[model samples]
Target: MLPQPNRQMALAQYRLRARFYDAELAAFEPVRLRSVGCLQLQPGNTVLDVGCGTGLSLELLHKGVGPQGQIVGIEQSPEMFDLARRRVARHKWRNVTLLNAPVASATIACQADAALFHFTHDILRHPDEVRHVVGHLKPGAHVAAAGLHWGAPWDWPTNWLVWMAAMYSTTSLEGLAQPWSHLLQHLGAVQLVPSPIHGVFIVCGKVLSTGSEVVHHV
Candidate 1:
């Protein structure tokens, strides 16, 4: 669990990032597009984009799930949430709903068909928080997360220390592949698949309704 002070700091960081998040993340590029393509999402699926910053992931999730699908985004920072809401409104995404709250404390009201986290893991300050997210997920659901890990060669240690100093520790990531594996195993996800996405590694897995392997894409 992260210290309350640290969580507050992290929220502040995201609030600041919300201003230029779209340009910095470059959500419109093909790299981000293909990152979630393997899921083969269809209509009527309910996708929750946890920690959805500036709503970059929203557009694609909306497109993948189509008009029939529902897209809900949970953001902790009010500024970020405001920015995301504005972005969605500008695009006229009627099915997309932006809720301002942290992933762990946020009330989901309904079980998600699939959940998403893009560049959200590293920012998470503790392991337990991620596990808490899994505990709430419904069986037979799917999760897809893509993000830069600890040793990404971006002065990560410095950034980590800065974030940690504010109160909570940044996620202790091990390579781009570790975050997904750690959460998938903890969540008991079946038929797990891993892939590379630019500066990060992405994983897709299904939560078994009866703890059974479902299907294989490859």
Candidate 2:
């Protein structure tokens, strides 16, 4: 059986990585941009940033939504959230809201037009967490996710890279082969976009309206 994700372990992990998180993620900045681009946000739209760490994606998301749009970031680690809070404060982004809580239980006040889950493997592994985020989306709202995953069985080099990154960032490596599967359950017309880097993927889809069927395109 796959090991379940441990919240306390994740919290402890981020406590140590928070200070250096942004620097560590520098190489994946392109992936972050692609994920936000998949959202296709518009002015006055509200977007949720799931597991937003140190607000690295905030600038891109803010630019996508513009000053009129709203950005709600949900994070569980106090250390990470503090940096995110400071980032928002530094830029004086009035429309961004930071919620220091787990994604499954965070009190998301708005029905967002889109949600972005960039490199949030642990959150995507939890069905309850994915459902909770999907439940707050407006019908036909866009959803985008990007993260590391196990490569083909013979691709040991790529898999090694993924393992090194996942060990540092995620509490559980379960479901790494198809990390976005749970999130896709509540979405329709899914499209899996290939990333430039091996062992990484970017998925874009829209929320399934009542009675809508799920469709996936590679």
Candidate 3:
């Protein structure tokens, strides 16, 4: 197992990168589109954008959920949340709420219809965080996530790309081979697909009944 990320280290990392985050993530927009599509959101639906860095997924999610729909974004980094808050303000989006706290400790008042976890590798590795977020979803709510992962051993080029991306974005490199596995513990069986990019993956599934046992990690 990869060493669990130090919260302070992760915060510091995003604090420095928040300004350039949107620009740096431009190349992965297509993957974001694909991940959001898996949600199949409907009008007036409530969705949770976990680790919603710089609010990159906000507009697409808003488009899916519509004005009547509510979007709650959970972002731990203050610097990143500031940009996201500005984006919401600039857009005059009244239906959105931004939570400036880590997912494991954040309070999500309403049960959401769907949740998105685009590019949230570190969050995915923490089973407690996964369970806490999934617990707020209604049964059968759609959940989709996209992030980096290691490719096959022979796929050296892809692995290199994954390494570079993970080193820059994640606090630790644990679970790069199966970043979505912890999520599957709560989601049951997810339909996982790899993007054309060698070390990228998208996993989509619905929440099982509340009685389903959720695996908890410390």
Arrange candidates by TM-score, highest first: which order?
2, 3, 1
Least well predicted 10-residue stretch by lDDT in candidate 1: 165-174
Question: Of the candidates numbered 2 and 3, which has the greater TM-score value?
Answer: 2
lDDT of 1 by residue, 1-218 (tens): 33222566667666566677677556435555655674557788888887787787787888888998988888878888888889898999899877787676777766777777666754343466566566666786777766554334576674464344222213333333354655655444433344333334565776656657545432
Off by over 4 Å in 3: 210-218
CA deviation > 4 Å runs, candidate 1:
1-5, 122-125, 150-177, 186-199, 213-218
Model 3 lDDT, residue 20, Cα: 91
Best by lDDT: 2
- lDDT tens readout by residue for model 3, 101-129: 99999999999999999999889988999
Query: Tens-digit lDDT track for model 2 on 1-218?
Result: 87978999999999999999988889898888888999999989999999998999999999999999999999999999999999999999999999999998999999999999998999999999999999999999999999999999999999998899899889899999899999777889999887877889999999999999889985
Error of 3 at 52 (Å): 0.5
What shift in Å separates residue 116 of candidate 1 from its native position after superposition? 0.9
lDDT of 2: 0.93
RMSD of 2: 0.8
